[model samples]
Target: MKEFMTNNDYHDIGFNGPNYTWCNNKEGLARIWERLDRIWLNSKSIMDLSNAVVKHLPRISSDHCPILLQIENKKMHNNREIRFKNMWCSYEVAKGIIAKS
Candidate 1:
């Protein structure tokens, strides 16, 4: 899997979700089921790759449920308040306010 990911230029968020999905069903010999579904993404396609995460959802009739991805990135409007205030005021008031402040 690592080799395949590397070949495809994909970055792995690492193994997440259920470990095993299939189990042998037999009498006297009991078997437990596990998770098998996983998620992956391209390294170049993601920003702040370290902030990306995966979570497993509840399993239904299928052996594996869907995986959820949470990605974080730098806020585009980090200084939106300042920009909004500037836009709200005219040049004369802005100059006066700046001078007073």
Candidate 2:
């Protein structure tokens, strides 16, 4: 997370929702939970979104939680969309791709 934040120039958006975003749904010593969900934004994007909000939705059937993000001031956002894919990072050559691009 540290490397990704520094390299991608992203800052946490600090969401509002359940404290734990994920869990094994078990009890006793077999149980586990974590705040695995989060939303991040570019520092420059804040200037464009005066009312940006992120919500961590309640856990459902999936093991991972859901996220909802709203940008209230779209007029100034300039249509820039940042996308990240975990699969793209699996390859060893991905570092070069990320660096070169």
Give candidate 2 misplaced runs (Cα > 4 Å): 74-101
Tens-digit lDDT track of model 1 for 1-101: 77987889776465455655444444564766655555667766665476777766556665456677877775567554543466536677577777675
Off by over 4 Å in 1: 15-35, 73-101
lDDT of each: 0.62, 0.80
Per residue, candidate 2 scores C-alpha lDDT tens digits across 47-92 of 6674888888877898778988877654555567768788888889
Summed backbone clashes in each candidate are 2, 0
- For candidate 2, the lDDT comes to 0.80
Task: Look at candidate 2 and give me any clashing residue pairs.
Answer: none
User: Which is the leading candidate under TM-score?
Assistant: 2
